[model samples]
Target: NQTKMFDEKKLDINDEKYSSFGAVLTDDNNFYFTSARNTARKTYGANEQPYLDMYMATYNADGSFSEPTPISDINTKWHDGPAAVTADGNTMYFSGESFKESKQFERDKDNNLKLGQIYLFKATKTDGKWGNIQPLPLNDKTYSTGNPAISADGKTLYFVSNRPGGQGGNDIWKVEVKGNNTYGEPQNLGDKVNTPGNDNFPYLTTEGKLYFSSDGRKGFGALDIFVIDLAKGTEAKNVGLPVNSGQDDFAFSFNDSKEIGFFSSNRTGVDQLYSATPICGVEAIVMVRDANTGKPLASAKVAILDERNNVIETRTADTNGKVTYSVDCDRAYTIQASMSGYENNSFPIAKTHGGEVNVMADLRPIVEIVKEIEVVLNDIFFEFDKSNITKEAAFELDKLVEAMNNNPEMVIMVKAHTDNRGSAQYNMNLSNKRAKATVQYVISKGIA
Candidate 1:
């Protein structure tokens, strides 16, 4: 049930008359969402085309909601919906769009009024009333920006934008929330999270996980919800299956304390809300380092191999010599670390019941040279009459394997000698077997 935690049912709160999406909740069970159904507004003078607006409702204990009403004080003639409130319940950030009053609501080429690009606005709650609405300083009148999500501490704000300097039609961006109602410059989320298509509706959880929607990345629909571990710097992963379908799926909001969340999708041909529960999984972190010097090996290739030695995923170690992968629980995995001048090392991760697993892949440096023999392996002593490899023999042979990898074209011949304590015929046969086994071990390491 990794991505199928919910049955994908449209919320009963949705009205057949209009599109509903972008739902967030307060601790008191009050729901705030976006809807285009409430088109009636006293501010519109004439010929006001219907647009989305923010609505509020009280969620009843019987799984029903009170009659939803638009938050009239915040609605505009143009689109105004989708909002995120701070944990303190004192501040709110929401989407807003309208024809600029500075431009006198001028019309564009299509006889449509020039759009005042969508941007996020903030409002403060004072004496149980929300007012003092103001646009964020980063908003630009030319390019659109919306879909605000604030961190639990209110120190960071994440949103979507179609502004210049983005990798796609719409990309997610974030800015540090400077205290005293100011913000730092906005930063694009980069190519890993942004594509040439739309990416929007970024939601940051208290645990530092980023959940967003993307039409650009590979997904199950036009826009599917995806998540990434901001702390680990992993790639965006689709929250597939029941939560996603062959339609647009976006606007994911979750409350960690309540353990339930809602996301919007158009699977039934109309945008509606769906409840979802978070799924549990395991994360594997592989740290690669030098065995001798104990220094972090940056840019080392780390491959995650399954039980059958099949390569599942490969990643390069960051500057900290660490790479992480989201893996299933109760399954064995192997991590193979390889660097240019180091002997390849493999570490096995045993099956776990489900939790974080840390692996250390310490690689031994390939000894440059010993004598003129071209290959200087460790002293691999064999038993009195045994030809099979032992633990010590295998450990020593790894050096030979390392040497062969360092000099790919170089070749060495295995010559085995037995002590005079054995018969000449028996010694001859024993020597031949030892030589064959030594060659087999070398070949197993992908060397001649």
Candidate 2:
């Protein structure tokens, strides 16, 4: 659908005051966005400047929005606004300035309030109202973690964080939702998606593509919405034109079907919402299989290489021995597929008109005819002092597994060895553990 272009238009929902750039369309047909219009302060003082707050407006059937209503329950007097809601509409995750009521604002030497780093917060809908606000486990007081974007199934949450150990200023991070509010450690999105500049407002589409605005990557404006196909593992590319402009453009969100979407932009000098439509793209499907037997190779490691032969992305073939990635037209690519006991294979894909591109990678089996005391197999390597089977070791073990599968009557012994660095007993024990782990890994791969 990359051939179509979008005609962008600013929504009538703009005001002279500051308006935050995030907006999400919920399943219940209500539009939710961030705005600083509701900053009336009572806790601090009457003259204190009001901060951003989450506002909801009803989406009428005639394409106009009703009067906006600020949700005071979730909004604090400090900073709170736009949020991402789950498909079931039961939970909401949003960004807000860190606060604990007592220590809400920390002032500087001049007694001026120092803005707190934004943190992610969660709230659940009960009886048609959102309450039970809880901070995410990954939220740090020293760093900021806001701009929440939840996956469709609600298992992963992606957000922008200025946390330590980032590629640059405010890199994007994702954490696994381990059910019942527990979360795993946050993982940086890496240098591919992150840049030396600020990258915020991550929006994950239903199709596994991440769309976020970044001033770091090449773009037409200050902050352009660039989409990276998570499944394809390609570099992010700007969405271009009407959706992007010379001003800051970000906070992109799409509907369930992806037919139409909304994004916030400051092209009009004031932050306002705009709608976008998908224009061009193609689904590139790659299939891996055995060259001789024509059997689909499941679990095959597929690496997508660009013109410079740099592996931009890697994917594991599914049970059907197939993986699909979205790509633009007029770009060439190569795919390398490798499995245990097979010669690595590469399939070259040439650029063409926009559409689906099917690639077949046929890997040849590496047969080692042995006449020695034991049928020799390839070597298995492990990390330093670790007994876990690495991906490389697994590939070697696959060769052994395939040999055993081919000759059902053959049984081989595992001769474990260790160097002289460790204590004799300790080294022996570690080597034995490694041997046992290798056997278990083979069994786990269905090689009895």
Candidate 3:
């Protein structure tokens, strides 16, 4: 199972003042982080030294990140840092301090910050552009919410808060999406995962593994990244070494395979980004086509069946008349291709390791037309009342010759027709002359 690969790089922040944290990868391989480089005055000012802000940077396919650019709309003069991106790379959820000056650190009876709230903003792609932001309903003024973590499906959100009713100082809470742009009430993750100490910065991998930073257990530093199998138990274990050094290691996200992840660390004397690569299995690709013409046919469907004929992966061909899919090559599969007007085809494929095999199966159309039949012109017409053959008459006669040559055994009687506008004897004479001319043209072309 050690087939997956991962590589890490330390993202460079060209500016000397700001530091990077909470690095997440997008489907396009771009990375997003938070920083506090040049925030001094705006809608509100920060009481702390570093007024943080979120930023985005693109990562080239060669595993390098571009210079960071501040997401100014979401960033403000107040503290804002550590963002979590959805797997699709469209939505963003992050933690930030209130940007309003009139309400600075106002606390309720429970001493929770009334203005600080965990905010969720959606970024949609319209005409290949992204810039719209909307707030989520789970944010409340009674408590301070930050350190957001979203599930791979974008249906569940997890964050840390110091509101009321928690196992410790900052307990992890979850909000499930109820419908379009709506979410249910926030619920605590319960004692199985939370401790009396602070538990925050939750990161969920595609495989359902949970990674977060906590100081509950004896660790190397103040906050250490821990992994917990939520399905089994929440007893967290440190993701040792290069990933977690003696300092704070939080804000981690993984690809679908759960083998590789990106996390931030200050062990290098600066809060930088690093990646962990684990062995991941490769997915398979398959295609189908028309055997005779080599032309792609749309609406064709393909299915992969196991030894017991149980369907495994089924997909329909896209508009390009091809279907591409990825499947773990763990077992032998019987590939089947079928369409409504074509005969079905099937072949067996043996599983192999880490290689792309093009299994293209061509299907034959069931009701096909043969190309051996010859069709001939049965009649030729005379112009008006004249008996002379016209140029157009030669054109029709030449086609008859071509048909006869295409089918050697074909024979035809060329008949000439005349409109009944003339006298019977004159009409008969004109028809006779036209038929003779047609026969002469056919014979000239070497057709019998």
Candidate 4:
């Protein structure tokens, strides 16, 4: 469940401060993200970073990008940017604040605290430049509304705000975009999607799935990306792993097909934009257990071998006797498992495009074969005249080794029958050498 389900690529547009992430794959090929790398701008007291400015660059298909340029027309000295462009790319809705009435900083008026609130502004691109910028009616003096996301059809606008009648904190609200650039009343998405915690950055896909960021739900960490199907009217589900982590992850945007996408996260401690591609690789999970009892064998050794039988990695299984590996797409693998007091086993994993491959290893327990303290086998007569332990004698020694393994406290004294093939002194020496050889053979098979 914690696997990286997506083939994610970090964007090069990231600065050490904040490279930003919002709308992606605009029609003009223009990229947008927030950056606070400009030391020239005064630092905001909130996060202690420089004030954010709308940065732009030319996006390439190979995940390469041109140098970022600040959108001066929409970027005020205050924090700006994180803009959403319509399907045509002619219209843009961005987050910024007006500097009118000495409101850049220090709202001195005791009752005038609205100067610092963020506003959603709409701008039109003409002759390759953004102008005719104006704030949307959703902005108010008492509350903040910004981070706008326009639906693909341009009939609905989704954004974050702390206005009245909200679920709490920052909630995602939508308004109907009527004819003539007019908007209907803003409506909260309700508790299904909105919580009493901060929820922001909504990107609605043409397929009716709304992807947004929130700290309100259960996730790996601070903020995670979630998706709720607006058509199905279900609660949001956490889009886990690679896309989310033990840090703030938000601002998810996917193309029309929801294949290629972009999202921002502070998993590295510095916020950056990451390009997400669906992982077509296969996930192989192996579980090892006892063959006879059918119970899990903990701490069993599992080795993953490639198609050529070359060992990739030898890892120990978890408490549940499970070990997982990220295998390549369309590549076959073999999972070999081994444990003490059990015979080793191996299983096969077939090639797959993008899914899980579960394999189970059932190992046979080493049964006790040695019964009596003294035993003479049928085809096993030791050559007491020589020092070399015969193959027949070694075979019986394995049974003794298995017996010692089963009863750790059992100790055996070896005795050898001698032949009068030489002098009495020579026969006595042969008997001692044969006894030593028998004990050595059993000790070699892991018997103490």
Model 3: lDDT equals 0.67
Name the top TM-score candidate.
1
Measured with C-alpha atoms, the lDDT of residue 300 in candidate 1 is 92
lDDT of candidate 3 at residue 268, scale 0 to 100: 63
What's the residue-level lDDT of 371 in candidate 2?
35
Model 4 C-alpha lDDT versus the unseen true structure: 0.79
For model 1, where is the 10-residue window of minimal lDDT?
A: 41-50
- Encode model 1's per-residue lDDT on 1-448: one tens digit a residue: 3424344556777877567999987667778999877746433333333577888998777657798888878777777879998888888999887352355233476875554577778899888788998877777777777899999899999989988899969989999999766999999989878999999998888878888998888877589999887888988888888888889999988777766678998777777887786555567889899998789999999989899877898899999899988887688988888787776667899998554698988987776543467566555778889898875577567667767777777778898888898789999999999999999998997885
Candidate 2 residue lDDT tens string, 335-394: 878787676656888986555688988877756533355655556677767788886577
- Pull out the clashing pairs in model 4: none
Residue-level lDDT of model 4, residues 232-260, one tens digit each, is 68668887887888999899887754367
lDDT of 2 at 429: 89
Superposed by TM-score, candidate 4 places the C-alpha of residue 19 at a distance from the truth, in angstroms, of 5.2
Write down the TM-score for model 3: 0.54
lDDT of model number 2: 0.79
lDDT of 1 at 93: 95
lDDT by residue for model 3 over 1-448, one digit each (tens)?
2223334555554344445678777777667777656545432344333566777888676666787777766665556667777777766776665444335345666865454554445445555455565555655566667788888889998888877889887888888866567888889988766789988889887667788888786667877777787765646777665566688777777765424578777776656666776433334455677889877767788877777667777788876667654556466677777665565667677776533456776766644321334343424556676767564455445455545564567666656778878789988888888778777777888876
